[model samples]
Target chain A: MTSLPKHPPAKRLGLAIDLDTCVGCHACATNCKEWNTGGISAPLTDVNAYQAEQRGVWFNRVYTYEVGGEGPDARTVHFPKNCLHCEQPACVTVCPTGASYKRSEDGIVLVDHDKCIGCKLCSWACPYGNREYDEHVGVMKKCTLCVDKIYNQNLPEVDRVPACVAACPAKARHFGDFADPNSTVSKLTRDRGGYDLAPETGYLPTSKYLPPRPGKRSEAMPAAAPAPAIAGAGRFLKWVDRVLTR
Target chain B: MHPAYSVIFFTTASGAGYGLLVLAAIFAISGLMPATAWLGFVTNGLALGLIAGGLLSSTFHLGHPERAWRALTQWRSSWLSREGVLAVATFVPAGLFAIGWVFLGTTTGFFGWMGAAAAVLAVATVISTSMIYASLITIRQWNNGIVPVAYLVLGLMSGAVLLEAVTRLFGVHGSHVDVVAIVLIVVGWLVKLAYWHSADTGLVKTTLATATGLGRFGSVRLLEQPHTEENFLMQEMGFVVARKHARRLRAIAQATLFVVPLAATIASLFVAPMVAMVLALVAVVSLAVGLLTERWLFFAEAKHDCMVYYGR
Candidate 1:
């Protein structure tokens, strides 16, 4: 069952994240934790909560980085990373048990707690580090893309997207069937040139990240001329005096 | 990458175990070894005991050891599953061969064919074990040709040393086994050194820019980490060893595993039979300690691709 499906699924459910607009607010990560803590992979336990060193399992995380250098070209980019639901998810295929598997129906990678022996091999096989082992449950856990909520018949279709996508304050996260070229997520990817995290690894990740926009160049400021000797001497003497005092 | 002790023991012990079984099969099939009861008891018992012990130890690291049997179900796609299946399958012919040679005093006909089959399975098991790491595309250091070569050669070298020690236990004075052990040790460590060299010079295919999809925006460096403290991924994959310490460990591994073992095997040739047995025993003990350190370093030095996100 861990083997890839013979035919690709008709619906490759995935996300399109706009890296340019992400502010690294961590709202999506928090929302994801809040929802998943009570869902399938429940109680993503934190061992040392409110302590100096806390460790836990989280499905989504936001990382902030400084790009380029100082000047107008310098900019901060926030990347919200999660499971990409790769078409060739090594995490699924490398599983010793059939617990970690990709759904043939929707192409969402998931772990069945019932069958998992918690060998942690799937995590090692994954290039993206999306899967985290839940020590409390003694099983591997990962981003389900809100499978419980998304597929719930009782929930309204509009409210059926992933918790992270719904909670993104900047609306940076988009959820739709990427298998359909006409879907909004697919169009967004096509328009913004959304790319995979590590294409060289050949995972063929379904989740795409829109690259940060180019920075604007600012005019360099002019240097100030040195002051005259007597006044400058007084200023220099004061600076020296301050330095000596410190 | 965490270098869990159980797994280190598992791979090392099982590898040597299978290696010895393969050699035993070859010796029996080639009519090199006489079907003696003591030899059968010592060799078969040690080999199967190591294999069983290693496999059991592997389960200790798993969260749900009770469900470990389920791992064999997905051999179609998983190397771990394939290894499990092959490991179990190997015991069948190996067990039959042991019964025939040790209890019934037979090494021909059914026993000979069974020994041959067991040898093939033993080699296949080692290959399956090596592929478990080699097939992984995430850890650049492990996903290489040298990893499997190192595993295979080291296993054989250790097994050869063990065979020499066993031969010395009796009054046998076969210089060929000692020479074979010495040759295997030299070959094994050379491959290991090559593996280290490759890891040192290899270019990591992915970087922060590519991982984040922000290369066009220019160079990217982490400004803020996702968490204040370590997470599961960080705990499992963020293990790092100091360069100086790694160098020291490598030296120790080389000395005890290769140099000392090879020297002892050679010295055993000139000494009395009693002294030679003692020298062979020393070689086995030293090799175990050295391989333990080497296996630990193997895990410690590996860098996971995911660490790029954390600026590691």
Candidate 2:
């Protein structure tokens, strides 16, 4: 009973945040909120009325960080966080009821809300702090990787991608089947040397983030003193510059 | 993270059971006992048995209770596995010590001193089992090294009381044991107070902002939950607790587990032996219930990072 057909070696559905390109706009968070609000599985909780405006939603959140760098080299690291969907998700195994189960099918971790008891041990077991409680429904919720959208055939082919992937104005977010080595996401991860956030925690998330490209330097060689001749190449450049400026 | 009542009862009752057995062994080794004393043997055995029974009862929480034996396989990574192993191993010495004390009581010789050595081993074993819970880094409250210290102290106090009762029945001089019991009670109380003080500093877990870096945008908050109902992760891990109720419960625990027990032990020095014994018994029962509350609060009061999504 413990074994399943074609278990994909315990896929950890995690995200690799691009510390480089993230603008901290929270588009991912918003999109995640939108999709998860109507998701099939665990939905986040939004409590309190419009009186003050406190609410809960899950799947994604963006954070800004300041890591050590040089003078101009200093940079802001914006991280979009989600459930690592750990290879050893204590949250799933600790469930008294079999409500929490890491899928062997596509490796998407899920919850059966019907069986939940609101016990709360899985939260303590997670160092990443990804699990969220739904007070309204008295259950737990977390990221599902847009399982509905990714698998739904009714949507247009391009739009089938996760909402975060679709909504990224900067094109910073990328989603695909990371399990396939030939997949765009996998190749991208390899070329960029994408690293797991807190790899030491050993969750081994499925999503990989392409590291920020190091800033490159290309110098303009002093403008060449605008050769007195202005006639040949200089005259042509001057004409182009005048037109571009206008 | 409020612990279920079942778990709270499990740890407290079991701790006392193990703790008392440890004390019984220690007392027998000290040779302070008169020859042919059967009281220590019976008292220690009963305490040890109760601990064993409590552990067995806790297995009911497992979905596949029959597969509980497989839990021992994870000792390499899991403290629970180690705790289970040590719990069983501890009984070996406990039984040996118990039997040795009985023999020494029936006859007199270095057999009594052998009982003391067995007692020392039992003490170490009990401490090890308690540390299994206290050493978990994930559980901020239980992570402190003092958890083991606290368990040992309380165990000693409980054991001391049981010893006091049993020895008094035999009319064996019980003042020395009573004194040790009082010292342990004081020690236990101070440890619990320290634990509470440290725990009170702030949340054991982090917030969504801290967890997800969502706070960078001024004041990031959950606007809506992604799900409509409770899921397994939320049900299993999203336990919420009330601070006001916790405060009330803490007072109750301190009063019963520490205050009453401490007072009763001190008064034992002055009161008639039987009266003193009865008071200690009352104190013991109150302390058990209080500890159960304390254990429940231990989990209840702990906040989880997941509550961030819960809109706590």
What TM-score does each of the candidates earn? Answer: 0.94, 0.64
Q: Which residue pairs collide, candidate 1? A: none
Q: Where does candidate 2 chain A have its weakest 10-residue lDDT segment?
A: A216-225
Best candidate, DockQ-wise? Answer: 1
Q: Runs in model 1 with CA error above 4 Å? A: A217-246, B242-244
lDDT of 1 by residue, B1-312 (tens): 788999999999988898888887777667777788888888888889889999999999898999999999999999999999999999999999999889998877999899999889888888888899889889998899998889988888888988989888966546667777888998998999999999898888988888887777778899999988888998899987534498899999999989999999999889888999999999999989988999888888888899999998
For model 2, the superposed segments whose C-alpha errors exceed 4 Å read A1-123, A128-246, B35-37, B103-136, B202-205
Q: What is the DockQ score of candidate 2, to 2 decimals? A: 0.07
What TM-score does chain B get in every candidate? 0.97, 0.88
Tell me the tens digit of each residue's lDDT in model 2 across B1-312.
656655666677777786676666565556566545367556766787778777877675543456556545444444555566667666665565566556545322455454555456556655655665554445566667777777777777777766766676677856688778788888888998998887777344455444443333334345444444644435544665546687788999899888887787787789897897687777778777767777777777765444554555
Query: Whose lDDT is greatest here?
Result: 1
- Report chain A TM-scores, every model: 0.87, 0.79
